[model samples]
Target chain A: MVLELARPRPIWQIMFSTHHTDVGLLYLVFSLLAMFVGGAMAIALRVELFAPGAQLIQDAMTYNRLFTAHGTTMIFLFLLPSAAAVGNYLVPIMVRYKDMAYPKLNAIAFWMIPPAAALVWLGMADFGWYANPPYSVISAPAPAAEMWIFGLKVLGVSSILSSINFVVTILKCKHPDLSLGKVPLLAWSFLTSSIIVLAAMPTFAAALLMLLTDRLGVSGFFNPAVGGDPIAYQHLFWFTFHPEVYVLVIPAIGMMYEIIPRFSRRPIFSHSSGVAAFIILALVSFASWAHHMFATGMSFTEKTVFMVGTLAAVPASAMHVFNFLATMWNGRIKFATPMMFAVGGIALFFAAGAGGVVNTAMPLDFITHDSYWVVGHFHLFVFGTIAFGTIGFVYYLFPYITGRMYNEKWGVVHFILAFVGACITFFTQHILGLFGMPRRIYDYPEIDAWISMNQLVSVGAMIILVGMVIFLGNMIYSMAKGKPANLEDPFGLGGKYYYPFAQRNPQHGEGGY
Target chain B: MAHSNWAEWIYLGVVTALLIYVGAEAWNVERIIDHAPADAEIIIVTGQQWFWTFEHEDGTKEVGELHLKKDHAYKFEVTSIDVNHDFNIPEFVVLMDAIPGRINTVWFSPNEAGEFEIQCREYCGLIHYNMRAKLYVEDV
Candidate 1:
């Protein structure tokens, strides 16, 4: 089997294959490609922001386009698809099924990403990721903004289809003896997030269409000039996205679940509570969407309601953090690269959650809204927490996917640089925001605080770029020439484990016992 | 397990109480900020593609600059002539959306006699970053 994976196959064969593993591999590769592309744009933006005025980017419009594309690419192209990649690889195997319930549909879902990504990259829309109107409708450049909408629409449909595949595969294709309660925690994470995608994605899909039509001058759904309310678009967009945040994070948490316990050489501390947290997090995510709109003149009663609604998520998220810490408490811990990333991710998760609490307070919203503080806060979640977990899981799965182990020393180096860089860049932005630097600005008035902090942020971004270079070099070099891994004990932790490939043949091992 | 359950409940209870306290305080702040004094002056602030226009109660219009007397309450009826912009006086934590076809209100009393900056907080267009104005507070 290792040889089979190591051997090169014709491009056409891999492209047309309906196997879940093949599709999963494709999703993983494509998501990594998107990550580097998006990360490049981020570095460009940060470099331009190194000074108060434009240094690398010539104009504000180009900066706008870069950040817009950076945001859209990272969220849709990298984060979501990467989670989907993990789901496709592990869900079927964990459920003791041979392939996804609808294998062709799974393939189709993976295939949709390339064209959607092309549209987003080619158009380079200047509107922000949310594409809020009437700016998106009235003032944004045409064809480019239109392409972004259609691109997102296609991506939305693709994810919906993928969610259906996951739901059916997990629920229907599980072996009869394997009860739903006993299904692996990672599978449960996929189930919860997939259900969320089904519920939350359609609102944004409809809003995107409305925005496109508004731009075409055929509809006035959110065009303030035509008796439409711009706030209505915000309401629709956040309604989908606030929950979409969980959709992006839950899978990473699931990856952590897989990593933390296995690396600690212990069973999960409380399996049931972890499942409960995922469900509660999903439900409460919907309640907090309106919190994003507090500055849009929501009434006192409305603002208070949303503020409390946002706070309601605290305990649920706390449960997961507690679960992880407790799981690692007295267990024999291996400080491997994967474990390091997982532990780092949890610590950052707390910081991100704390920032979120501050943002949710209605009074604090006035101070932080549309400021660099928001930029700092969400990136902590997306980059510090979610990306950390995803990248860690990629390292965890490296041995299984490529039949080779990543260079442990270089992997640790990459983690240290990336973690330190994230801390420097994001934490400084928080202070910068408090110092009155508004977000999405291509230039500032060269205040002392802004200038120094911008320089620090640019330096931090350069560190992360270097770390990413090391990471890519490690993956590519290790794949072709690294030492072969022990199939039974990959990390040299002696324990019984269920390997995905081994599950395909009962003679090799008990299938998902 | 029972002990852990107790700890979890206590943690959640404390969080809930803290959130309630903050919510109530935020509500009070909202009421205080949104409620202008009965004799407060009304300033109709209009935001366009790249500038701000402030019309005083007596129909005195000023573009790119606004003057208010210190220690006097003032209410701003903020709206946009073009797309959606945000009227933000960051130093004072005063912010409201300037949406076309809708007027949103925010009130602040200038306590200090000095000059400050006003900016558009939302992403409106190419020059959204440069969409700024000046505010002058005169001693009463």
Candidate 2:
């Protein structure tokens, strides 16, 4: 008697189900949507600042809400989730595990994001993403700030759960033969970043709770009028967020460790050093939080210690950069789309690192504090480095994930436009900041000397908008009609075989257990 | 992967030395605040949401602008009435937070006799962008 094979579930059921890859795909899709939402807000802000006479947004409340939403949506919804998305897709595969240790927990983590994001947009918090209080507590509209705080708390909880899953999965769920020492560098980075998330994110959650109580009039944790020290709030916030910068960048750096070697046709220059860099960055980042509080009244010794901490993290980053350049030294150097962005990311990281050093010098911080220079410095890291790495990975793995290849020429064009546009937008802001322009201001007087530079910044924003449109178009078209990846090792690196397609049944090998 | 390379050690050594140098320079720079003379002009600066109020020791109160004598050291005791703000004079390179219920001091001697910009470096509220004041370093 011939028995009919069990019918597989439909695509819709699978996508909505608790399967790890599908949940990861949902994370990617959600983050992509978040990027557009945040990007649109950014465009509106640039338009209003174009000639500085309140062009698009006339009301101060509207302008405040726009910038606040832009920052919150980007950091919380796009940047963090996108990093998690890459981790979700790659970590289990790299560790040779069938799925994350808790697939249902992963689904819950992804599901928490959408409603939290919705709550943020619904309220449109006007306090800056930093949400410095008593402004966030006493002055800014209550509904919006409270909603933002609630949203952040939920997101933080989701992050903690996700990090736990990652840590446990990496430590305990690897293939039997693979030793901890043999875990790939990308997996090591995820492990390190997850550990950081576990350690650092709870502090933010506690701070958010404190903020909620302060706003609710239940406690004066940050209200100076009631014997609370506002500086304590800054201490708490920066404590979590300073390490957060590493949380944002390290995974992207991990993706670089993966792509740079493959495209350069070399094994990673030094795997041990790369792993050391990740661990070192995590440790040094915690002590460097006070660098953000330089303007706050801290003792000279405190400032010096924080400055040392900030600078101490630099060596690890430098080692990573040195290793990357050395790996690409005299190699085949294929400029695939992924390769272009990886190389660009490392190159831009050098510039960002320089800006960071300048920011670290206690005396120099006086000049660049709260100025467009600081804005430019971070954008170099965020837009130029982190975003570059993430996009490159998407390109590198698109074929593997979708069984379709992205158009190579369009990918190159996308990178060029984004690079030029980002330079025009953020590089000028450094000059403008040096010229004494402060950040978070919605408008400036028309007769100010910054008129021309602001105009240039707006023009650059436009260019970025165009690039983004092309990117979105390219992604959608390619997903639907791009060529099938008929061959393994499509870039022809002749390197070790490490894509996830090897023996899809992950539990039991066809040849051996 | 476990084998340590000499190059890595050398790289770490150079970075450590450079960091120590920068840290030392930073320590020396802290003297900018310490070296203030006892007789320097004192300005008690109070910041609110959208404006700066400079209260000079000589009983002159100025709003939105400060007029100072060039090449004279000025001691600024900055505080905030409502929220956290940073009293920053970009040209003279002075920045310190103006926190409510607390006063922070920073000293700078303006060498350039020109109109410089003073701004609140910390994010306050909606009108934070417009929280600017002019610094006029007139001839002594």
Candidate 3:
């Protein structure tokens, strides 16, 4: 049977093989493990903030390290790697290629992540993820912080290598018959995201190296004591960090584009518009980085320019959202689990984008800056929107990868719990921010109202944790005992887009350039 | 199943409204920036490890706190002694970075007389969470 033939390769082969599929599987496994590690850190953070005072964490130092680890692990360890895993597994397949252009390079790129992640956690760097100077330069525990920087350097190098491989593979190895116009949105997404990675990662690498040298007393690039500007560091850090948000979200939107059409039994409402949106989003990403530094006392003209640049992205995002809605309209909508998650992701992205609008306006940012409101808005985007889209894609591709159908009942339960839990957790934090609560505090002032709001936020975080537990359980259970799926159209939608990776002419032999 | 495509147009209409709202809000921000109160009381706000010190117009200094007259605009010339810190009074909707060796000025008028907390929003060091200052505004 297909299930038997599609069984996972042996452990040794999986570890050592240069095949893109095997390397991609390893990336997924590592990413899942990193997710749990990062998720545990979140639980710790939530439990500490469950009450007003620090009940669980031993001291402020531990709390600081916990959060830094949490942010670093989630952003670098989990989110980026998981996204790469999805891209690595699917891009070649979608392009009808036998393998990535550089399979050995692909394996090397993935293999670098674990050791780099280990270096970060083992050193337990207390510097926050951005690690802005001169605290990062002078005050942080030097050896530990250096390890974190080095780890990030390694991860950056890995991403750049992977990006090169992706670009080459996508551009050169795609099936000759498949023109650029006919490329799947997911492939297009990966291609665009790869270019972004190529462009953005090196700047961060340069920043990290400068930070390392500054920490080691080798240079004074961001050292205020040596006439270097600390604000300059903010400019540099956010230059990459802000576009990094797009780097994470664009691929997610691409995955949603792939899912919605299949579930709606229609082609994307406007493929050209969707492609244009992706390209515009990428181009606009660079223009908006300075918006993150609005509170850093730049001139009014600078602030207005960055604010406009930031808000300018909304039209492209809105275009994509409208296209999604249009695709869903006038179609036989399937209420399948993937469909539910994809739809849920779209809805949350709109809410998150609305919050983004609030953040983008210069005056409103004064109220929300560095408050729990910013925290809430970002979590809504990353967890509520990006995570939802990625999880849906995972489920949508489950049958193709495993040749088995996941438990429909369990998958539905996972989607509902995740969606509801994300809403309860992140949305409440926005109110807490508006109530004047600051973020990254170990213990807050014991004002009664603030305490109550903090408690509510903590409760919501727990709900999200519970939902994630269900999700993890569902993935493990379904992989083992789930029924064999109908290979061509698992949902029986009888649509042209049912199978995402199906070649147009059913050319079985590999015909990629 | 497919329905009338009215929602797409409605969504686009919403986008148009949002863009307009953004333009209006941006102009409001410009007004706030360009028209800072001329007769505001000036305070030199300095940040250090785990605390803040405020020097009033008449040369009296207070650590970890500031006093102000309600309905009077105040401009804070904020700087840090050692590292980067954000001087943020959440209730007053005022935030600016306090960079070492450079003063960043931000102004606000307290409309209500009450005790407000000032938090260092930027990550400074291990005791960053403990960096706090109180603002007490006197009623007219």
Candidate 4:
């Protein structure tokens, strides 16, 4: 099997392959590439922000474009795709299916990303990722914003297609013996999230079209000049995105489920509750969309209702965290790289959730809304918690994909640097927000608190950059030359640690079914 | 198992109850903030591409700087002439969206006499970061 993976097939053949693993590998590599691109932009932004006035970047427009591109790329091209990569690889395998219900559709879904990504990059739309209208419709530069709209539209279609494939594969093609209740937790995450994508994505797709037409002077759906309301666009956008947040994180939670139990060598503490949490989170996500717009002059009753809706998600999220802690309680746990990341992610998830609660309280929202506090809170979720889990899962699957072991010491170093960096950067941003630093700003006055905190935030970002460099180096070097893994017991945790390859592909060398 | 279940129930109940309390308080605060005194002065705040323009009830206009009387309730009818802008006074927690074609209102009484910073919170355009104004709250 190692030889099969090592043997160089033509690049085109790999590209054209309709198999799940090949497409999954493509998703993985592309998303990692997107991460580097987006991370570079973040580092650049941090460098420019190291001081009060601009340092590396020349102008505000460029900075705006950088952040817009950075945000769109990180969410769409990195977080979403990385989760999809994991789902693509594991969902079919966990369901005991030979391949996705529609392999061709999977390949098509992946193929759409590069062109869409190119459009976003080439355009570099300066409007924020939400592309809130009026400015988007009236003031933003032309072809660039138009290009961004088209890019997101295509990407939206791609996600819907991929989601349909996942839904069909898990629900229809699962082995009859493996009932829905018995499906792996990872599959359950994909199942719930994919359902969310199907329901939530179309709203944004329609909004994008409306925005494009408005920009074209064809329609005024969200243009305030033509008897339309800008708030309407925000409603459509957040209705999709508020749920899209869960679509990004649920799979990361699922990855935690996969890692924690195996490393601790215990069955999940409560599978039923985990499943229930995922389902409930999916439902409650839609209710909280308007929480984002509480400061947008929503009615008092409306604001209160959405605040309660936002709070409702807390218990569901807490269920997953508690399940992880309870699973690790009093168990023989190996502090491997994956286990370290899982634990760290849970820690940050707690902080992120606490920040979220504060944000949901309407009076507190007045203080934190659109401030650096919101930036800090969401980044703790997306980058700290979600990215940590996904990166750890990549390490967990390293041996399976490459038939080689990563340098354990280096992996731990990477984890430590990343965790520390995340804490320094995001935690300080929360303080900066309290000191009244608004988000999406290209510059700020040289106030003492702003300058010092901005410097600290930049330094923290640099640390993360160094850690990621080491991570990329470790993966490339280990994949080519590291010691071969023991196929049967990869992590060497004694006595049958749930390696699925042997069961699924009994004929190891004959290539995957 | 029963103990764990009980713990979960108690945790959830506490959370729900706490959320309800917060929500009720928030609603009360919202009402208080939204309610302007019947005789409060009206200031129409207009946000454009990169500056704030204020219109006094007597038709006097000021750009980029607003003068208000301390200890006097002032109601601001905020709107954007161009796009969407968020009128935010972080120190005072006076925030409302200044959207075109719609007048959103926020009211505040300045108890302290000092200079304050008013900035646009929402990302509006290239100069969004520098889209700032000064507020002079003088004792009258």
Best by DockQ: 4
Q: Is candidate 1 or candidate 3 better by TM-score?
A: 1
TM-score of each: 0.97, 0.95, 0.95, 0.97
Which one wins on lDDT?
4
> TM-scores of the first chain across all predictions?
0.97, 0.95, 0.95, 0.98
Question: Which window of ten consecutive residues has the lowest lDDT sum in model 2 chain B?
Answer: B1-10
For model 1, the stretches where C-alpha displacement exceeds 4 angstroms are: A1-5, A503-513, B1-4
* lDDT string, candidate 4, A150-184, tens digits: 99999999999999999999999999998999998
lDDT of 2 at A305: 85
**Candidates, DockQ:** 0.72, 0.71, 0.63, 0.73
Docking class of 4: medium
lDDT of 4 at A201: 98
Stretches of candidate 4 exceeding 4 Å from the true structure: A1-4, A503-513, B1-4
DockQ, ranked from best to worst: 4, 1, 2, 3
Candidate 3's DockQ is 0.63
Q: What is the per-residue lDDT of model 1 for residues B2-43, given as tens digits with 9 covering 90 to 100?
A: 325666667767876876776678777767666678898999
Report the lDDT tens digits of candidate 2 across residue range A1-513: 000011233556545566566677778888889999999999999999888666999887898898899988988899889988888877888888878899999999988999999889999998888888888888989788888999999999998888999899899999899888778888898899889988998888998999999998999999998988888888889988989899899998999999988888877889888998999999998989989888887878888889888998999999999889878876898999999999989988988998898889988878898889998999899889998998898788677666567888888888988888888988899999888788888877665668999999889988888878888888888776788654457676665567555324222224311
Residue A176 CA displacement from its true place in model 4, Å? 0.6
